[model samples]
Target: MAETTTDSVLVTESVAKYDGAETARKQPPPEKPADVRRRSLVIVSFWLIVLCLGLPIWWQTTTIYRAKLPLDDMLDWAEGRACRPVFPLRISVEANDLQQQEAQNLLRLTQHALDDLNDFSGHHLRLQLSPPGRQNESAEIEDTSALTIRLLPGDSPASALHPYSSILDITYPPNSVPTQTSSSSALATYIAGQLRSTFAEEQAIISYLLSTTSFSNEQRPQGLTPEAAESLAKRTTRSLKYSPTYHLTFSLFTGGHQPSSWDIEAAVDEFMRPVLDVLTPIHNFTIDTQIQLYAAPSVQSQVLNKEDLSSFVNAAEWPLSPSIGGAPTVNFIAYIGNQTIGLPPTDQDASDGALATSQSWLVPQWGTVYLLPLPEDTTHVSVLTLKQPLLTFTSHLLSLLGTPQSGSLPLRLSTLSRIRSADLLLRASSTLGSLARLSLALPSISIPSSVADGVAKTMAHLRLACDTLGTPEALYHARVAEQEAERAFFEKSMVGQLYFPDEHKIAVYLPLLGPVGVPLVMGLLNELKAWRKRRREALEKGKAKKDT
Candidate 1:
């Protein structure tokens, strides 16, 4: 009983001790709910402010503005889908004495024959019959027809091409005319042969052009030989790329200051006006003539060999800079000197036979320079004296513009237009393809709205140019298209912003994120520890009460 009582006393003391401890703990220690709420509110408010205001402002300040581009349309324009060029040449027939039915039959048969003979579908010749007895209708016909076929009854069959005019004179017996029922006739066959021969060079050139370009091989003539292809390639490479206008600079370069001036204006008007007038459809030329004295070539050897030809220009000393405008410059230089060209002879005596002749050379797209030996004291050149040089320049200009060497001036100029159009179309397309590849290659490059705007403008202009190709207006639109495409593809800002590296971005972000994140994370960890301690104390008090 005594031990039990002793145990009871001990138990009672322990209980008393526990009660005292419980009462001391139940004093409800600081009731930090307000502090907890205040701390949470501080954090929550800070995060809310950062997310609502700071993040958006940061994004707005750092984000790049991207604009939409019409990439597909641009690619299509470059691929030749936007334009398929066609040349429809008009040919008028003048049959003064033939009856209406006979003339119509001839026309039908000629059309069939010409179509059968024509391999180049791009340049189709259409025949139109002029009313009989029309006076000097040749002048009126010249305005519309590329060429006029004049038929006259004679004793025998013969044909002649009228110089200075595009007239094909064919004399035939009156009985040779086809009847309405006839499918073919001798006159028709003769005309077809004549027409084919006339346009043979043009057909070869056009076929060669189609083959060299991105145009499908199915449309190109398969008959072009390797030699022909090589020649065409040379011609195309030698020619200047197309522009709306061409600046022709006529320079008279002399080693000495004897002939300071020439009647170049008068000479050009006399010798070159006709050709210029003919070429006006393909290119607008601006002529500026100047006399440059004391211009010495790099090689001053008495005899010039093949190597001397290249260094003769003295590009460093010559004032042959391209003109300020967008048009290309063609330089025509008449270098007055006594230096002889030492060309290697094909035969042993060919150089000796040609020693006395003046040396003239064509400088690709630049121009021609004719080395003329003149009297030492002559001060002025007559128009007659300037004739050969001017004529050479005219030929060089034609060659530089890629005109066919074997055709009428009108026909060559027409061909030049077609070639230039194809060149420009391909150039624009290639530029577009490059831009597309660039965009694909660089993901971070910011494409500005201006680039998109330029791309759209380029595509629109390209479409217009393609639609109007082979016309006078096509050049204008093509020029615009080319300029716009260049601008779009080479947009400055696209490349300008590429200098900043990814490392720099990471460096910039690290400072702010590092400092701010540490404090917020530590504060949340301390709050969690305090909450766990309070819950453990409450659970132990409940267990002690249940045991008592």
Candidate 2:
């Protein structure tokens, strides 16, 4: 009985120990919900602070502001759909000696003939009969006609152009007049042929210009000879780009101080004024003359060859700086020297004097320098002495302005206006095309609102320019269009941000995003895992109780 009691005591002690341990395990670990809640609140508050404060600052720093642009409208203007240039040249027929009915019939026949002969549809000549009262004073009448065809009775039909006026004098017999019922006449054919010959150079130049540009190639003249085309290309390339105003700078360049002063002002007024007055319709010119002493040609040889002509102008020393305005500068230099131009000594004409000539030569678009051999003591050039040089300079200036080599000054100036308008229109179109291409090529380029504004202005002006093309006002509108197109295409901000590459963007964004993203992501993951563990523990406990 004693042994059994001792065993019961041992068993009771073991049961007490087991029960104490079970009670300790079931106490739920002091209920630390406050700590967990505080920790979660801290983590969420940190994330909220970062999200509210950091992201906005990064976006504000890195964001690019893109401005709206009117690219489509600009492109439309550039495509030649906005405007079509037309030149309706009015030619008055002064037939004071003919009856009104005869004159009308002749005019109608001539119009038909001219229309048949014309290949270029852009330039058309409209024929009109001058009133008897204005026939005699047709030379003074500037507004109605570009040219007047004066019909006089003669033995055989012959034509002579008036030297001082835009008059084509045609001597035709009285029988040459067209009959009322006739659709064609010898007189009409003669008149058409005369008109074509007179305007042949202008037409060729215009045709060549059209061929060289982006205008439809199929419409270009196919009859232009290779030599003629080459010559035209050279002339066009040498000429200054069209502008409403042009600055003419007459400079006297001398190797020594002997010939310093020249009567250029008086000389230009005398020799160049008439030509300038005629050219006024197309280009407004400003004249400024200067004399540069101690200026030497690039070549020191006594004789100049064709190769030396390129380096003849002392570009470094000459003060032929372009005028400070919108217009381009045309320099005319009169260099005082004794150097002669000749073919270089070769196998054929090595010692022949026939190969050599005067040293003066034209420097394409820059100017012409006449090597005048004067007395060492002479300091001033008289107006009479300057007459030849000034005249030569004037001719060179005409060529540089792309004036037609044929035709009178009035006709050349008119043609120049047409050519200039065409050139500016093409240039503006090309600029717009380039801008469109650029925008397409560089996707990251940020276009500014200024570009958009400029494009809109360009398109509007281009439309006006195109509509008024071949008219005097076309030049004004074309200038505006070109300026605006250039401004839009070369907007400063568009290219500013292009140099910043994608690698640079990544480098800029990685630092702030990488550091800040890590803590937020980890905190969310930890919260999710804890919630899943708690739900699983509750489910297992319910299952265990059910099984029991």
Candidate 3:
């Protein structure tokens, strides 16, 4: 057994020796110069291709798409430097009772008084004497006149605005008319005061807009007192942004199965259609009504406080999604509950008439809510019952659309168009500015070509709107600019990839590149070293032969 074991060990050693010798014998001889040169050339070619072609392809594929924009111009628009809004109102003066010379003199004095009283340069009233013969053609002249002044001699100086027209009628004593040489007169001052009072709301609104934006102090009007500014701010905040259309939603929310249905369609048609028809020139309306049963309010107190009104809408469970379109939704919710808002003094309620009322409350930029207390057995709400609520909704709707509080329906709608145009213009400019600042702050963020196109379109439309303000076309252009600017600022590609860091990109690429790059680089380096040594040796040999 010992001999056999020894034989096995000897056999293993002999086999290992034979295998080693066989492998050594099979090994090829050292490479020739041509073979070595070919190998070096192949490695060099591979490295050159990688550096020159592969690297460029990789860089091109991984690079972000950056589009050029007029950053400076966009910033200028945002800062209110590019466009200075000016409202040139032409007030026509009619003095059929007085001579041409007297009318012209009165007009000059009133205009001077107006200029002295005016603190805002952007909004100015220019008085023009209507041609004496144009009195019969007042309809033709009405198109041009922002306001018309009709003078009549009376016992005392008193002024009244024509409720139906933008006409101010003043009964002045004969002595109140300005003489040819008189620098100032009571009649002129009275007219100026009336004009200021007539435009008080408009002036306050425009001033509020300027003050809210980044307009320079020089551009804003000075007459906005803190109290007035506060009031205007509330009104502005209460109003929704300008839109071509608005979705009117009439919803009946009930805590129980009773009062589940309402005649909302008839109520809207009867009480709201006239107002909607009048608003057609400035805005369009789409109506939809729904009945939600077993609905609960967020707050259940019998006497809801001021804060409770804000949370009354059960937003989580309520189907109050905005209409699936560009237009914003105005929700008119009629909740069936006995909850009453705690009463405040007359002064407190006056400041917040919409929200403090027991009948209904208006939610800023959202909609109105009416708490309806019904009998336990009541199931269907009649059109008559819905009348008061619908009327309340109509009045609040006007406020939501930013209509002038004081004016005939026609005049208010006209003012709405102009106000909306200016609002959209300023909003678009502000958005452009925001986008410009964002781009500057984030240099690495990739701005896609679509964003550039949108920006270009916005600026072009903005210019057109700025030049044609107060006209319907201006509102169209302003809307386009606002839409385009919003689109550019919210570009999905730009926003989604804006925060991706360089470290993340490197981490993603390292695994694929490390194994391949090291081998290729080391092979090239070794070949270069060998070639350099061979060249140096050849140079030394040549020198030795020459010396010999």
Candidate 4:
């Protein structure tokens, strides 16, 4: 009985404790509509800040601002569709001895013959008769006339080009003169043939240039001989890239210490100054001279072969640094040594007659090296001794500047201007094409307004250059176009910006966006799930009421 009573008391105590614990549990009131709506509004407000304000701010800071460009017109210039180059050469005829009517007839007949002979349409030689006493107007004629043909009577019909000026002296027999009634004469035919021969090389070179470019079929030059084509190709390759200014470095390099000084300044002033003065209107030159003693060549040969010429320059030790400007440097080295050029190995016993005439070798696109076999004990090279080398350097300079070999000095210089203009025009066009292709190739690259401006300037100047293809202005405009196009194409900021790829953007933004995005997303999702549950419960309750 006592055990049962104890057990009942224990159970009563345990049950009382459990009932007290259950009564002690607290339950808050149900959430009001106003509170729940306020919570949802807070969530929406946060989302609205992110969607409307935050995203725009982020985009504004990170977006790439690219200026628009005239891509199609640029492409047209690049592909040679915008302009075709045509150079009309005007030749003035001075017939002081002939009557005006007779001179006009001869000019007409010669032009007809020239037209029949000329196959290159891009180049035309139009003859104009200078008024009788107007021939003394040297300034005006020099500016306009490409060449002046002076008619002089002689024992036989002959034509000779003036060595110093752009004059072609033609002597015609008294009977060979064309009459007003005659349709043709031997003098006219002779003049036409002579003119054709005079410009034949220029025509071939221009034709080759056209043929090699994106020129259409009609503009291509016809009947270029294989020999002429080969010669032009060599000439083009041998010439240095054109610049408005050139830095000529006259260096006297000697392996020994004996010949340490030279009279280079006097020699240059005598041999090179005249040509430079004549070329002043086209190109500018700045000269400097140096003497290098104890200078060893890269090739340790007593006698140099044609093969040794390639590796002759001691590039590692030579201080042949380019001048401190945009102008290109040309090194004229007078190496004082007893070394001579050996004939080819294929001809062991052949006469060294042809090789003896040339103590120097031309280094294409660089400069010339004249091997002066001075006495071992001699210390100075006089102005007389440098005459041959200076003359050789001058000749090489002309060749390096792409002067045509066949024409007279004045005519060659004129032709060089035209050639250089054409070259620059083509270079600028090619650069534009490359830039266009590059823009297409890299879409993510940022284009600045400066780049667009440069491109616009390039195209503008390019159009002008194309219009004035044969004139000096063509060269000026082409140079400007080239410079601007290169600047635009090689924009450092654009090239640097190209590397900031999409992957880098993601990496940069991931830390900030990743953490902020997850919490906002999860909270919105939880709110949505709770709202869906509430809607389902309300629908079930409405169904149950309808059933009742």
Q: In candidate 1, what are the lDDT values of residues 217-286, reduced to their tens digit?
A: 4555667789978878767766777776899998888998779889999999999999998887767889
lDDT of 3 by residue, 331-384 (tens): 999998788778653413434345556678888888999888888899899999
**lDDT values, one for every candidate:** 0.76, 0.76, 0.85, 0.84
- Best model number under TM-score: 4
Q: Roughly what TM-score does model 1 have, to 2 decimal places?
A: 0.78
Give model 3 RMSD, 1 decimal. Answer: 6.6
Candidate 2 C-alpha lDDT tens digits along 360-469: 55555555667677777888999998888888878877877888777766666766877777777778877887787677677777777788777778777777877776
TM-score of 4: 0.88
Supply candidate 1's per-residue lDDT for 159.
84
Runs of candidate 2 with Cα error greater than 4 angstroms are 1-67, 136-141, 216-225, 317-327, 343-359, 518-548
Q: Measured by C-alpha RMSD in angstroms, how accurate is candidate 2?
A: 6.6
Better candidate number, 1 or 4, judged by TM-score: 4
